[model samples]
Target: MREPVDARRTRILAVVHARGAVKVSALASELEVSMVTLRRDVEELARTGMLRRGHGVVRPMGDTGPTTVPAARGDEPVGEGAAVGLVVPERHSYLYETLHGARTALEEAGARITLHIAPQMAGAERPQVERALAAGVHGLLIAPRWRSAAGEEADYGWLAEVGVPTVMMERRPRPGSVLHAMDTVCSDHWYGIHLAVDHLISLGHRRLVLAARNDSPTARSIRAAFAEIAAARPEVEEWSVVLSSPNAGPGEPGTLEEAPDLTAHLRERGVTGAVLHGDEDALMLVQRLTENGIGVPRDCSVVAYDDVVAALASTSLTAVAPPRAEIGRAAAELLLYRLGRPTGTTGPVRRTELLPRLEVRGSTRALLRPAD
Candidate 1:
């Protein structure tokens, strides 16, 4: 036996009016329904002027004073606006492109976006988030800095406590942890690594090497996918080179010198194909190889991870281009959907992963045919 949708929602409104402001967790427990279900109901009621949602609590509409409630159902109408907060880690090139896409989508939906720029240090995002909340944002889109492997838990638990709908851009929950229950949209780095490996295998490359930056969050996924592929294809000999530090800033030379002689290492391992994590590392390796009289795609083929600096290289490199703008647009759309409905109930958590496109260029070619 089950209560009707309207009946359940009516009960929810009754509880809100009775309690003044009720915590979401408490309301969900009282209704004997999951938090997801309760959230959907609350969202719908808020849209129709029946209730108002604040950080972590629901209250009866107009209880505090006279107020104007935005219509819950309608297409994008001018002057009907909601404020959304966006937080990102600095103005990096990729992040800028992602922000552009988010802005475009928000504009199309008749929403206002407030930008918050935070540094890449841990705990630096909390103040920015507080500022957004104080500014009366209805929802949030955030890209948190990477946490160390040993960090006790996800640092964004405050998001759930605050009770506003949130979407994480380009971030995933730590492995084996369900601590944060928020929607997410990110590029599929694992799939991109698979594409890189498959492309190399198709080019008669049996001896392969993966040059990765150990500092990147996506490094784990890339390594896992590469190992899985290598294990399945036992004939391919694969090795890895992890850069100790991320690439140095512009005009900083001798960074590669600090690293081991990668050229000698690759030749010693008999690796004929290499998948480099960034264009900087790939180009640096290629320069060293050329100086050692090794010809790229003649004796060795190289594929880079990010397409940001791929074409700028002296020898254009084949690269995996993550759908940066697409990720932003998809994230913004998901947040808008959450705000528009609030209490919309679905079975599974909402997560969208966009695939990266392999941009083939002059850097990769088939091995020369062996003499019959």
Candidate 2:
């Protein structure tokens, strides 16, 4: 049963006047009202000049007392009580850091976060998003598991009309598509791949091989970027792409299994340099190479794609480290700006990209010259 509007506002104003200031979450809980209902009441009261709504806190107009709430993140205030939904694929350590970054930023800005992890399967994100929407989230941050263009397009129509501020993390929509107009923040993977390939070429490596997964959007992008980079470079003598794992088929990304060891193949093909996607695959392949009497940086140079565990490898694998956390922070900040927009004004869509860096380690070295 809905409480009478006058009664609710009377109680709300009483609490604010008594406490001098209160967080939106605490106020809503005290009033035993839904956030949606509380937001409507607050908006109404603010319009009638009864209260002030800013910095995600409600306070009486003349009240200047200190708030019990902790200091917020940035100097600027995001609207109080804003809750956002975070959806990511399961078991993605790379994205887990992204989630943490977003959580920190939102919590610092005085916003609430509702997290939902999509299971590793096709069409898992929609239901989770529906749940968030039903619960009245003000915004969303999603890293959809897109294995192919078709897979991504299937979600575009519905996602574009989610009716709230949304920022995609580490995912890019197709050019001119409906989602292309949506806000997004992703690391420049092409630039990351280029950094790895260029690093290898500068070390006098001509023959290169890339063993990478073909399961997710990042994996597909890395594969294509490697092919384009290797083909475009006249310095590259031979390059090839092989499955890093045979577990996930090209069409489905549920099972990520390791591919057969390629130690003998690398020897037969005279490949002196290799780039491996993901930290685990690189570590495992390097172990296999060592078992076959091939020493890293001596017989074969390796560059791992993800840096999550690359630094922990026995050889301390050199890696292209994407700005995983920044992607989330940027996305969250953008969404907050959208949420706090002055009424009757909508902002332009934004697509932001952060650069990745090369972490040089013991895994790569300059090739031995004949003179030496």
Candidate 3:
């Protein structure tokens, strides 16, 4: 028997209320009705302010938008007109790439974004975030500069008070922390470090030194992952971590006008293979190693992290590449999904991690002989 028009409309309302949003075609298919009939029903419901219409979709009244919605049915621009804020550290090229990726996706979705760069200082993120909030953004995408554990903890109070949907980009709060329940997009740095270590071990490298910065969360995570991976490997005879650059951070090993004597340090311990963090430090260290009579991959094999400029180095460094732009894309996509729900909607939070890949190049090679 044909469902009555009033009955069909009521059912549609129930589905929309439950799902938050529904595509027009999906609603029609579920009701076993034609597009023409569904349109008439939707129009009536919208006229009564019981339903909201979007590009080929329908939502319960008071909904902001749809979450991770598909391209869906008809000829209409798909966008929510939401205003969002983005925060990232200044003078960071890697994160700049992430920012660009997010900007494109949000623009396509018809959302306007306000960008703020937090200078490289402790507690720099909060004030910029306040500005964004004052601007009345509906949501936020932030990559906070958690230079220290205390700095990260300090932001928790204000972040909790933001009172808007937020997504973190490339920053993972420690488990059991207040921000742990927040949404995040991060690179699987542990896996990236494993790839570097595994590659070195496979090439008969027994001794390794990780020259990395203690500056950012990514650098710290890589350092910790390297330590863990290096210790567990039976083939790895010795491993130690050192500062990648002068004035890097955390003030271990102190700064020197002349770069640390990495060549002497490696030779003193009979260490062979080295994994360097970031492009600039790796390039500089590689040059210094050359000047000190250590040929890359010939005297001491090296693997650099952060492929941003690794391949462009003089020796073309073998490096690990975290998915930078993808982190931004996914972060933005998740934030959009968060914005779709009605105000005060509470849902399960997600932590997304994208894996990084190793780019093999001339800087790393098979062991030709024992270290001289």
Best by lDDT: 2
Alpha-carbon error at 27 in model 3, in Å? 13
lDDT of 2 by residue, 219-299 (tens): 888989999999999999999888876653355444444565679778888888999988888888899889999999898
Expressed as tens digits, the lDDT of each residue in 1-372 for candidate 3 is 877888989999999999888877567768888666887888899999998987567898889866335631233322356678999999998899999989987875557689999998878888999999999787899998776656677888788778778999989988898889999999999999999999998988899999988777898899899999999999999999888887666432342323367989889988779999888889999999899988998878899898888998878999999999999999998997777555445479999999999999998888777443
| Quality of model 3 by C-alpha lDDT | 0.84
The TM-scores of all predictions, comma-separated, are: 0.71, 0.79, 0.77
Among all windows of ten consecutive residues in candidate 2, which has the lowest summed lDDT? 70-79
Clashing pairs in 3: none
lDDT of each: 0.73, 0.85, 0.84
State the lDDT of candidate 1 residue by residue for 154-271, as single tens digits: 4646655666678888777764455346688988998898888889889988888777654435555666777777677766866665552244211123223134566776788887
The pairs that clash in candidate 2 are: 56-80
Model 3 / residue 120 / CA error / Å: 1.8
Give me the runs in candidate 1 sitting further than 4 Å from their true place: 1-80, 151-156, 244-259, 342-348, 369-372
